[model samples]
Target: MRWSKPLSALALATMLAGCESIFGSGDEEPITRLPRALTQSEQELIVASNRFGFNLLREVSARDTSSNIFLSPLSASMALGMTMNGASGETFSAMRSTLGFGTMEPAAINAAYRSLIDLLLGLDRNVDMRLANSIWVDQQFPLHPAFVESSLQHFDARVTALDFGNPASVKTINAWVDQGTNGKIKTILEQIDPEIVMYLINAVYFKGSWTQEFDPARTSPAPFHRADGSQHPVQMMFMRDAEVRSVMNDQVQMVDLAYGRGAFSMTLVLPPNAQPLRQWAAGVTDEKWQGWIAQLHDGKLDVSLPRFRLEYDEVLNNTLKAMGMATAFDDVAADFSGMSPRGADLFIAEVKQKTFIEVNEKGTEAAAATSVGTGVTSAPPTFRADRPFLAAIRERHSGTILFVGLIGDPRSP
Candidate 1:
């Protein structure tokens, strides 16, 4: 029922500039403008995403403690949610359990996702947050109408019929992905294979300015301590007595940075030890997460964060398989009976993600895209990330994390 409005020039610049822009677009994308309120079901869905998100965070950390990691759990969730529509039997059960959806009825699940999307689409008037979903089907493949309707109604996913045999299909799908991610990700598909009958994609773009902007002139060079105990000079952005919410314990300190009207904030957590934040990330459960948020109180502290940019790409097939989703990737054993008439033949070929984040004086600009390839597939206090730390962009009201990262080396983008 929603209609498109003209995109502003500022939005255009942010999309085209990717995350290199230090500040958000002068104008934000118009809010959803819808007057409807979120239902209880939708609210529960948000909570589910949070649970699934944190679990995934731990797995990501456990998999690679040595390298810097960044990802968009929201993007991956939505993409898989769409694909989940056509999943049946073991595939459905496995996906549901892995995503923390548990035994929730599919009807309720879709409704929750729909409401979550609508609510987020309208939450921040001053922040540009966009979520896009689409399905591309091979001309020769036959998709189920029920699946199509569910995706369109619940996800507002655009359905396109394409000839996968033609190379142009790759460009077309990539174009949609690029546009959805504000060009932060230029391509998601290199070449569509004949066996690849369809693709389910989700792209998210977010740009938010600090409620209290940092003075660029105050930025100075500071030494950033690496995990290896080496110090490297970095452009350290400084903030003094700025408004912030923080919490701490013997293990780590958490700091929250507000954006615009405060519906969203970046939570940074600094662990005391030189070990990667991943080592401790697995311990962040819903109850513990709630405890940290409840303990946060207003505080004043001098902050020093390195001005850095990170662009990361990761293939999640093995990680997901290890997380108990092995059957989905096994072509011979997989069952996607709900996706297409030939569901038995369709298996998730791969799962991959691309993310971009830039933190500077004004604010932060970040975008991420998750491609299922049929495929289907933190916090801080005291506040200095001079060493290794963890960061997450989350919605304050729902506690939904849109983006998360572990910063090990900032010297390279």
Candidate 2:
């Protein structure tokens, strides 16, 4: 068997809003042209967000020492970034800094994301990857025209108005998520609360075959180490290829497993010993992450990896609050004035994410969804996981990590 970890994010909030005529002409709007080149600031922002994603990974891992974790910070960031477009003043400042966009202009951020998405979606014809965003507004609420246009032009979000108080709306939104994630996520919105006025949803899906597929015949039962110094039997997949790229230092060893014509790959980081993965991940940073990639060279090493699968769900309100996005979750302090006409009456009520992943000898498949809700009220919301291992799926060109996981036990179903 092969091991793969799929990830998803969901963010939901509520507010009052009405749609205006500012979404451009007809049912079909001119496709917003994306720049072929990414500015230095745009590039920096991508690097910064990757750093934040890993930091957030450590925070989530710290919660359950024995459980597994899988997440897509990209999904979370993109969904929240759409919501952040409407945030102003302190709320904007707080979200900007927390999401790692910093003091960068919102226009640049959106443009960069547009370009980045286009780049990733078009990177490999052999890899199936899709990134989608949508805004569901209550028919009774009045949304700003600019918010609608920006979402359309920059994020390619499908803006729709629905009766949020009706049960049918829940089904419609959930259906969209399901389809966007290739049905890996069946339902992101179970029941729409009466207080919920809007939902900014983002979904990501990826499927790719290994460039050099591993032979199933080489698989064997191997002894896997645990954090508690115990040993368990696991089906370890072995690969010994001379073309593999790897880097090692006193702290850790890194290996690159390519996929789909080499546009993307799984980067596995191993600690020097069977130390608790949480401890090892705490030291991970953008510099260290980049250094590992930079130092990678063609090297031959026997790679033995366990075959496993993971399904993870996480509530990120407290996590985001801890990460300095507290005000966005605060009902009184939160300012999403730029999003809806009733901005003063709105605040983020919840931010949730669900993810799934599977990896095997052939390749990998993963999915993630993130939903952000602004409402009249309030709410909030790994890997290895072998002996506790860290893994990330990244695009080779931009080094963007789409998924991060930690496995605690390969035996867990």
Candidate 3:
């Protein structure tokens, strides 16, 4: 429960990138954060978006690495709606450097990642335009521009529907979440201010299958050994599968596996000889990160990760400083002098993130929802999250993850 090891600002920034797709897929249509102003060409944004999506998938496969994430793919689902205000621009760039090996030429990687950037940028600016079309075109679930607003918040990009630090407006946000999650997660924003415009959010969510599936019949209220070895009754989701990754590290057996479509996966560390380490040893570094990745081999073992749902609604008010993004949030030093012709003062209002996850043997079912709103008069773009979803906040041009989160668990603390 405690990632005690402090991640250096640079290291934490690098680590956050590893969480783009805590649970994700490439085939799903995107649920965009609307209220985008697209006066500039998105050529760069569009191209980069596609590559970013694919690279996200590749990252999922090499789950053996330090980062286990999936950037949402819905951004690339549609193209016509990527432009707005009757103007057209495209974005194309990638964050391959965020992954590994800076061996390739910068130009080549940029070209490859631009496809993804396009999609991410498209969602930010052109999503409302696309959503207007999708409600009629999409059959299963669709949404309208429930609310709208624009700001030169994060640098120069005009942002809309941001609820970050406000504590009074949870109802509206709750409605959207209720809609997007199909009511799976309710009142997640109870503690948030509907007026708070979230500028940056980073969320992580995951669910893992037990190597040995729990027998429905064997399911019993067993006392789970706490970090203190104390007992607590927990519903053990058990499953026995021959297909599993096994690694013995520090005498502990680690079982790691992925969910369907490899959207997001989980890795479990079990203590051996009933001896647990002092904390999770989250202090595992780049070298250990590599070893954990290499240890995935075919093996058979009985495993039981306490069946539980753990979630974190990370409010990045302090995280901004944690990730070196403090300037953007500060009213004084912040220079968002590009978004508006008026040279608008761009300061982050808030960065609210909510994540929910349930772990079971079959697979994981989760959703991430985030709305970074800016201070504006026009009723902050209404974003009704009413069904299952995955959301992101990125540069309309570069497509970096400003924030990402999942919401599917019904239980909220």
Against the unseen true structure, what C-alpha lDDT does each candidate score?
A: 0.72, 0.74, 0.32
223-328: candidate 1 lDDT, tens digit per residue: 9888777887888877888778887667558888877667778888887555555667767776777788888888776677778876677677777787778777
Question: Which segments of candidate 3 are over 4 A away from where they belong?
Answer: 1-175, 187-213, 261-264, 270-282, 342-344, 375-413
Assess every candidate by TM-score: 0.88, 0.87, 0.49
Tens digit per residue, CA lDDT, model 2, 362-382 = 677777778887674121001
Better of 1 and 3 by TM-score: 1
Question: Which candidate should be chosen as best, given lDDT against the real structure?
Answer: 2
Instruction: Give the residue spans of candidate 1 off by over 4 A.
Output: 1-38, 273-275, 375-382
- Give candidate 2 regions above 4 Å deviation: 1-37, 377-386
lDDT ranking from best to worst? Answer: 2, 1, 3
lDDT of 3 by residue, 229-326 (tens): 45556655444443555675555455554332322234444434544332223233334433554665765554444444454444434533332344
How does candidate 3 score on lDDT?
Answer: 0.32
